[model samples]
Target: MDKYDVVVIGGGPGGYVAAIRAAQLGGKVCVIEKGHLGGTCLNRGCIPSKAIITSMKLLSLIKSSSSFGIDVQGYQINFPKVISRKDEVVLKLRQGIGGLFKAKKIDLKNGDYSNRFRAA
Candidate 1:
């Protein structure tokens, strides 16, 4: 079994950032992420919310375009399209962060674990 200098339990912003810093300092690091890379921030929480907010802002701008003296009408917000775009943005950012982790040579493990230590 290979022992790492550091083992991080989460892949959230804090954990992943710590792992990267440790690796930069020449320490062998491994990150255990039961969920997707970038953790909640980049996976299901912050990034998703930000993307949705972006869509909302865009929709608002379109709806209020006439206020800016731009002649526009029949503007509609496609909820499904907005959601799809948000998912794409989140996925792209997640993959980019994952690539960064890989470039830093941080071992990323994805799976659920319990309190079980088997004897070899």
Candidate 2:
């Protein structure tokens, strides 16, 4: 097994940040993530939800464009496209985190290590 000075159990904000910092400090760091990087906040949670909300908010604004003296007509909501955009946003953010990890020389492993480590 490869040795590491720091082994972060999750790739969420806390875990990835810690791993990156450890690497920056000249430590051999490894991040073990069971799912996609950036954790729930980036994947199924914050980022995804925010993307959808932002799209809906824009639609609302466009609907009320008449009040702003802006003429708008025949706007069709492409929900699949909206969802695809959200996925793109999430992918981009995740790739960013991956890039940072690479620059820091932090190793990323995919697997749940939660059961392997314990407080002693």
Give the poorly placed runs of model 1, Cα more than 4 Å off: 116-120
What's each prediction's TM-score? 0.88, 0.93
lDDT of each: 0.83, 0.93
Model 2: per-residue Cα lDDT over 1-120, one tens digit each: 688888888999999999988998999999999999998999999999999999999999999999999989999899999999999999999999999999999999997676677554
lDDT of candidate 1 over 4-117, digit per residue (tens): 888888888899889999999999998888888787778788889999998898878888888899867787778999889889998898888788888989888778654533
lDDT of 2 at 35: 96
* Residue 49 lDDT, candidate 2, scale 0-100: 100
**Winner by lDDT:** 2
Clashes of each: 0, 0
